[model samples]
Target: MSGAEVAGLIAAIAFLIIACAIALIAIRIGGVTREIKDTVAEVNKSLDAINAEVGPLTHEVEALLTKSNTLLNDVNGKVAAIDPVFTAIGELGESVSDLNTSTRNLASKVTNGAKESGKVAVAAKVSKKALSLLKKKPADQEAVTNGK
Candidate 1:
């Protein structure tokens, strides 16, 4: 073969090799871009699912808070409603204590009065018996004086 034709053949082979290398690089880049796009889509999908789930969960938490507040209010209302009853019960207890004290004092006074009255009755009976004996003594003296 001639020298010029041999040189041309070598140049064509080098160009073909360079073109194949560039084509391989482009194909690899396309595959990498496709993988990146797929990963991004998956991440977005997961975020959407989380948002969907959190919406209901947040609502449920709010509902629970509302229910707790309502229960607390109801308990407060019931306590307020019975406040007068508790006050009345306290007043009644105080009155009963006072009554018990008065009754105890009255009973003690009555017991003391009865004891004093019993002593007076015994003294009156003794006086009556002494008077009767004195009256009989006078009659006996008169009988002796008459010599009967």
Candidate 2:
């Protein structure tokens, strides 16, 4: 073959190879795009299903929250109502403590009074004994004087 014809033939083959590679890359890109579209469609369907399922659950949760709030308020009110009882119990405890203190004071007074009374009784006994000794001594001296 002539040199010009051979060069032209080589150029044509190189251009065919490049065109084939570009076509293959384009086909691969088209396939990836289709897969992405399918994935997006599936995600949209899943989101719709989740929304449908959550609709009733949202209402149920709201109702549960409302009931919980009511119950909490009722508990708070009952606690408020019974708060006075707890206060009264505390006051009663203080009263009992006061009663105990008063009882101790009265007991101390009685004990001190009893101690003083015991001391007075001992003094009276001592005075009576001294008087009896004085009376007997005088009678003996009188008898001795008469005999002399």
Candidate 3:
């Protein structure tokens, strides 16, 4: 072939090789961009799921706070309600103590009266025995005097 024609054929082959290399680089870049997009989509999906779960958790925390307040109120109300009962119990205790003291005094008085009655009965029995012995002796003396 002619020198000019041979040079033109070589140049065309070099240009085709460079075009193929550039096309391969563009394909690789497109694949990388697609992977990055997929990764971003997955992250967004995970974030959405976490947000959905947090909704219920937030409500539960609020409910717990409400229940705690209600329990505190109930405790306060019950304490207020029992105040009068406690006062009444104190009064009842005082009355019972007074009753016990009165009972103790009455028992002591009864015991003393019983002891006095016993002493009187013993004294009367002794007098009766002495009188009987004196009467028997007198009868015996008269009998002896008449015989002599």
TM-score each candidate.
Answer: 0.49, 0.70, 0.44
Ranking by TM-score: 2, 1, 3
**Candidate topping TM-score:** 2
Q: What lDDT tens digits, residue by residue, belong to model 3 across residues 9-114?
A: 9999999999999999999999999999999999999999999999999999999999999999999999999999999999999999999999999988977886
Error of 3 at 91 (Å): 2.4
Error of 2 at 92 (Å): 1.0
Q: What's the residue-level lDDT of 95 in candidate 2? A: 100
Please give the range of 10 consecutive residues that has the lowest summed lDDT in model 3: 139-148
RMSD of 1: 15.7
Give the per-residue lDDT digits (tens) of candidate 1, residues 1-148. Answer: 8999999999999999999999999999999999999999999999999999999999999999999999999999999999999999999999999999999999899778868788657767898976765677777767855876
Residue pairs of candidate 1 with colliding backbone atoms: none
Error of 2 at 142 (Å): 54
The residue ranges of model 1 lying beyond 4 angstroms of the native Cα positions read 1-48, 119-148
Q: Rank the candidates by lDDT, best first.
A: 2, 1, 3
Better of 2 and 3 by TM-score: 2
lDDT of 1 at 8: 98
lDDT of 2 by residue, 35-135 (tens): 99999999999999999999999999999999999999999999999999999999999999999999999989977886878865776799998776567
